[model samples]
Target: MFTPQGPTLRELAVQALSSVERGYDLLAPKFDHTPFRTPDLLLDPVARALRELGPYETGLDLCCGTGAGLGVLREVCAGRAVGVDFSAGMLEVARAGGPAASYVRGDALALPFGPVFDLVVSFGAFGHFVPGQYPDLFGQVRQVLRPGGQFAFPLPAPPRPGSRGYWAMLGFDGVMRVRNAVWRPPFVMYYRPFRLGDVHRELGRAGFDVALRALPELGERPDGSPRCRLVVATRRS
Candidate 1:
């Protein structure tokens, strides 16, 4: 669902037909007005979780879109904060509206820094990367962090089978697959590609000791499981 200020149906169609980076560039100005942007409800609880876990010094917001996650980092990270993304248009908007943090346009798979941050956070950007790329992405994040530094993100529980949400996501992914197959410069985003088990394994291989913290603000499922969790992967001390 999009607000009145969000991209029009025609604009969204144009974006879907373009490459992921280009699509995002086209969408950058109205990104915050769409449901696609990471909600503050989710960011607030994750920020609280990180604050409990740290008084971290420097932080990075990987693939920091319009820099929503950077705001979270600013609350917990003491010294400097940085937002890194590959989209120049997105970075431009971020630089204009974000907190007084540095914004860099760079690839997440080959981060330019080394052991420079005490914390790194990402939100809603994983779907852009396929499952196989997780190892390299995690490794890059690990490489950029100091010993005992953390890489954290919030992950909501998967939708239950037979649910409307489940069908909606499935339909969305199916449409995306069809669009990519038929179009050039395929826009890659799949809702179910990044499973938790695979992510945990990839993080382990990337030399991160991973743990999950329940985000109580999202409440619990019918099975008494947390509806959302913060995955905190720490580089070994």
Candidate 2:
């Protein structure tokens, strides 16, 4: 769903047909107004979790579209915060809003920084990557982080089977699979593949010591499990 300020249906259709980079560039102007932007509901809790684990300097926000996660970095990092994305359009909007950080246009899989950051965080951007890309993606994050630095993101629990949310995600991913099969320059956003178990294993393989911290503010499921968790992956020293 989108606000009046967000992109129109026509705009969205055009974006859906483009490559991920071009699609995001097209959407970047009105992105914050869309449901796609990481809301404060998610961002605030991630900041809280990071604060408990951090006294960090030099933070980086990976895939930092319009700098939604930059505020989290600013809140938790004692030193400077920086945002990086492949989209120049997103960085342009982010700079104009003055999100208290520097912006860099760079690919997530091949970051252009040394291991200089004490913390790295991402929000609402993982769907762009497929399962096989996890190792490379995590490796890039680790490469840009100092020893003992953390790479963190929030992971919401999967929707229960037969639930409306479950069907919606399954349908969306199904549509994307068909679209990519037929379309050139495929847009690659899918919600189903970023499972917690798979991600934990990949993070470990990528040389991170992974831990999950419950975010109680998001509340709990009927079974008393957390609705969301912050995946805190520390670069192995």
Candidate 3:
């Protein structure tokens, strides 16, 4: 599911074997060319949702790989837009563009910034974190946000059981589990474990007042439920 500009099959294999940081380092150069990059189709609706919640002064993009989410921050924030990630290679690529934005290389679980942001957003990066790590990750995001500030991101409804997409994700995570059991430096990207109900509890435990907004642009399921939602988690004033 990659373009000619993306990494080769062999390249992907090497990445899977390496540590998560190193894998992204090698993949960073061609990340945008791969299906891994956050698509503009999704970003547009997320930006629309943010505009409704904002007129923010400063914004931060958590796990902002390749700076794709930085544009959303620039669109909503009136002041500075910043991106932070642990991957130096990703930050290098992100920094070259987005003149209105600055980049920082830091762990997501332990961010360096103060509560300086009026808004925080992330895209296509949560799968990298393990389920247990959600609390720490969300805590870090809250720490970097001002009181009454928002931490928002989009979440898609899980694929139906027995669906091709469901099987695809299940297979991927199964392989990952096997790899981590047999290999060094586990690459923790799994799709199925990130359920919305679990996340709502985690965000609440992390001290956020959480709510969900339907993104109708992504369309609806047969049951008329939204396929995607904008998770708006606010730090209490």
Compared with the true structure, model 3 gives a TM-score of 0.98
- Per-prediction TM-score, please? 0.98, 0.98, 0.98
Superposed model 1: Cα runs more than 4 Å off: none
> Which parts of model 3 have CA positions greater than 4 angstroms off?
none
- Clashes within 3 Å, all models in order: 0, 0, 0
Best by lDDT: 2
In Å, residue 214's CA in model 1 sits off its true spot by 0.3
lDDT of each: 0.93, 0.93, 0.91
Q: Where is model 2 poorest over a 10-residue stretch in terms of lDDT?
A: 1-10
Question: Where is model 2 more than 4 Å wrong at Cα?
Answer: none
Candidate 2 clashing pairs? none
lDDT of 3 by residue, 122-192 (tens): 99889888899999999998999999999999999999999999899999999999999999988888888
lDDT of 2 by residue, 1-237 (tens): 258899999999999999998998999899999988899999999999888998999999999999889999999999899999999989999999947899999999999999999999999889999999999999999999999999999999999999999999999999999999999988899999999999999999999999999999999999999999999999998
Residue range with the least summed lDDT across 10 consecutive positions in model 3: 92-101
